[model samples]
Each structure stands twice: as C-alpha cells, then as structure tokens.
Target: MSEPYEYWLLDLDGTLVDVEWDYVRDVFDTVGDRLDRPFTDAEAETLWHGLTGSRNRQLDAWNVDPERFWTTFHDVEDPQTRAESTYLYDDAAFVAGLDEPVGLVTHCQSFLTEPILDHLDIRDWFDAVCCCTDETGWKPDPEPVEGVITDLDVETTEGTGVLAGDGACDVGAAWNAGLDAIHVDRHGPHQRGHCVRGDYRVDSFDELDLP
Candidate 1:
C-alpha cells in the first residue's frame, strides 16, 4: 500500500524553479571582470556548485553579511531585465495543484526566494517558506527541516509527511527530520551512492502520486 502523508515539503531550486545558470554565470563573469581574472565556462560551473554548497560558509570567509550579498545580487535596476533573465520551472504551475498543504524548504536565501516567488506569482501556494539566513542554518543539518515541520504541524514519521527535493542533501534533511522522502531527478544523472536515497523518485511533480 502507498504510504499516507498529511503535508508536503518542497525544495525550490531545481525542483520548483528552473534557475538559468546563465544568470549565475553572468554574475561570476561580472565579478571576475571587476577582479580582472576572467573565468572559463568550466571554471564558472565549478564556482557555481561551490557557491551553492558554500553560501553560508562564504559569508564567514568573506567577512561580509549574507543579507548584503543577496541585496547586491538581486538589485538589477531594470525590473524587466531581471525578470527576463530569471526563470521558474515550466512545471511550477503544478504546485498549486497539490491537494495537501505544502511548505517550501530551500537552501536559497530569502532575498532571492521572495523575488522569484513574487515574479512567478506563486507565493500563495506555499503554506510557509523556510529560507537560509543569518539566523537559519543550512539543510542536511535538520534545523531548517525541523522548522518546516513545526510550522506545518505535520506528523513526522514514515507515513505522515514527505519531503520532496532534487538533491541528496534534501533526502538527508528529510531523514534527519524523521520524514519520508521523494527525490526528483531534474538533471539526468543520479548519484546513487550518495546520502540521498528516496522512498519515491520522479522527474516532475506530475508524476508524483503521493498517498
């Protein structure tokens, strides 16, 4: 029988939002241009992954504030240019189709989260959004995952709730917080040996048929 669930915890990037890495590439290029050390495409890709892993760490390394970094990144003067440059996943519209209450759990910082949700006009679909900030710790640590469950007031067990996301860390976080998991493989590759194993796997939300 399918496991029953009362709440759904969703990841934002790669899961709900299809962020164009070009925006990140452009940012890195701009930073490199200002620093006068241009990065190759390969190097930029490495930097992008590194940044994703080390967002909180970078704040401490650079001795700069997290909020400040986000403010600068999202402050493009032309609104249309920013909207044109950013993107939400084509399947994001399906989030509203969920029958149960859904909460957002993302490693993305608040400044980026709010604007992207506002841009897509889907902020209301989420019952709550837990973002990484100076106060909130990153995922795979269980703090943020626990926060989401607490806010949602969902039972945390094998059949009460499921955390769905696109990365191994998402699975780790869900397991750590005592919830079942659904792993979404947005990209083609699946790192089978990693910490992220799932109760169910799907390419898109349309394929997700949670009980």
Candidate 2:
C-alpha cells in the first residue's frame, strides 16, 4: 500500500459546501443590476470560470473597490437567512472522519468561511484554516497553499501531503507547492484540461482513499 499522507489540505466552497447556485446567481444579478448590464447564463458561466480574475476585473470595470463589494455582501443581516441560502454537503462529514491532520486552504475570506463552518459546527475539525484574503495572494499562486503547508509543519520533500479542491486554481496551487493534488468535481463541468493536472479525481469526499 502507498504510504498515507501526513497532512490533508482541503478546499471549502464547492468542495465542502453546496453554495446555493441561486445565491451566486443572485449576487451576479445584483452586480449586473448595479452595472445596468445584466448577464445571460452563458455570460455568468464565463464570469464564474474566470472568478479569480473576473471578480477583481468586474470591480475595476465598475470603478468599485473589491473590498467594498465583499464587505457589503457579508454585511447582509439575518444570519439564518444566509444560512438557509447555503448548505454544507454530506461529504463534509468525511473531514471529521479523517484520522490524519487536516487543514483547510481556501480562497474564501475569513468572514465568509467562519460563518459557514459555524453553521455546520465543523470549525474545530480543522487543524488550520488558511484564507486567501488573509494572504497576499490567492490560489493558483501557491503562496497560500505553501502558507498552510508551512503552518502545519509538514515536510514538502516527503510527498506526504495532498491538496484537494475543485478548481483549476487549486490543482495549480498544489502543483506549484509540490504537493499531490486531488481534484474534486462538485460543479457540473470542470475546466482542468488546460491547467494543472491532478494526482486523483474524485466526485466526493466519500471516495477519497488517502495513500
């Protein structure tokens, strides 16, 4: 048998939570409404595929600050309402089932991550949580992944760490960080053919057989 990984770096958002697609659609619609140029579903798909850049670019295009956009989104009152709009996936329980050290490395901001975890009551399951907003760079950049690997004190040369995520950026980040990558395809279609490759591809956490 292959040696078990010493550390497991997991992704949030689509990987662990079933972020209500309607909520995302609503956010995009809100942005479109604010900009007076509503997007078609096709345009929305393109924007979502380019989220890491499109978000900032959209903010720039609108002459709005990205920070302001996020702040306003999170400031929405009615925690129960927000919770109702989002949901934790059944696979999230798999994290709690893992026996090895597990850390979360996500592109989401702490403000958003904290609430999601709190709602699921799975905050304590992670040994570390690294948010891109807390770092100088985001995923596909490796720095954030490196930060989590460093924080967990895992030896990179040992090849005993795996980064699991659903985006090309996540695979790229794992490759750049020199860790094994596991691609989770939670969304309809994954655009991983052009970007970084993964060591394994799984549809859900229940399928993960580490090592």
Candidate 3:
C-alpha cells in the first residue's frame, strides 16, 4: 500500500530552483560596502552557507546596523535581476504538479520569493507559500512548515505529510514537526555518506517514490 500522505511541503531555494549564487554574492558584498566594510570572498562564502539563519551576531561584531543593512539592501536589490538568473530544476514542474496539496516553506524573503515564483510561473501551484520575511520561523523550528500546513487546512499527523528539500534543515524540520522527510541530494557527494537523517534520499525527484 502507498503511504498516506495528504500533503507535500517543499523548500524553495536549492530545492525547487537553483538560484545564482554569484548575484547573491554581489548583494551581500553591496550590503557590506554600505556598512563601510567590504566582505572578502571567504566572508561571502561563509555568509552564503548560513543564508537560512539570522546574521545579527555577525552584524553586531562588525558594528553594522542590522536593520539598516537589511532595509537598504532590500530596498536597493532588484527582484527581477535575481529572479531572471534563477531557474527551476528539471523535475520542479513535475513535483509541483503532483496531485497532493503542495506548500512552500522557505527562509527567503517574501519580496524576493513572490517575484521568483511568478518568474518561474509556479506561484499558483502551491497551496501555501510561507516566507521568513513575515517572521514565520525558518526550518528546524517547524513554525513555517506548521503554518503552511495550517494555511492549507490540513491536519498535522504522522504519515499525513512529507517535507522535501535539499538541506539538513528541511529534514530536521520534518522530524521536528512529526512529518516524513525526503532529502534531495543533487550532488554526488551526499549519495555516499549518511550525514543527515532522512526517511528517503534521492538524487532527483524522479527517484522519489512518493506515495
């Protein structure tokens, strides 16, 4: 028998689309310059790795005003510039078109997320789209996922839903929220080692044996 999942909660960046990190690096570097401190390539790499979390500590350490920095960056950043560079993965459409209710849970800002979805022409596919810009907690906290499920008017129960993404936080969020997890390892390295615990691991959506 197939697993009884009524919904599929998915991550946005790195899962649905591979955003151009080069443009992202430019944005971060621009923010650093606005704060009167230029971020080195190494610093930019580290920041890129922690895109899902808060950077208040780093801002404080650099004596930069967090609010001003983000406000200025967002105000100056053009959504189209970034959205034009982002492309959906080969299986993104197929997965999004699945019969089950689909929802998005991402730490990406709404201003960016909304336009990116529109650009990809998949905005209407999701039953719910939760962005961290609204203050909904990011993955590993379960609030964003829970919020999306609630918005979709679905009950959260064991075997009722699955969370799929390309990172550990996606799996952790599913575990924390009592949902099954599928880790999409698009890279070859993750296929060998068992780093993050997930119910299923696949290189692409084609390999995902959804119930």
Residue 37 lDDT, candidate 1, scale 0-100: 52
- For model 2, the local distance difference test gives 0.71
Over the stretch 1-211, how does candidate 3's per-residue lDDT look in tens digits? 2566788899888788976778878887788777777877655643554432345555666677778877877875888888998989987777655788999998778888988998989888898888864477777888888888899998786899999987777889999999999887754443323465589888788776543
What is the TM-score ranking, best to worst? 3, 2, 1
Candidate with the greatest lDDT versus the true structure? 3
Better of 2 and 3 by lDDT: 3
Minimum summed lDDT over a 10-residue window in model 3 is located at 45-54
lDDT per residue (tens digit) for residues 1-211 in model 1 = 2765688888887787754677767776775554455657755553344323455464556554556554554453234444456677766676787787789998766756777788878888999889965476777778887887888776665678888887767877888888888877765342232333488877776675532
- lDDT winner between 1 and 3, please give it: 3
- Pairwise TM-score winner, candidates 1 and 2: 2
Count of clashing pairs, candidate 1: 0
RMSD of 2: 3.6
Strongest candidate by TM-score = 3
What TM-score, computed on C-alpha atoms, does each candidate reach?
0.76, 0.79, 0.80
Better of 1 and 2 by lDDT: 2
Tell me the deviation in Å of residue 100 in model 3: 0.7
Scored by lDDT, model 1 comes in at 0.69
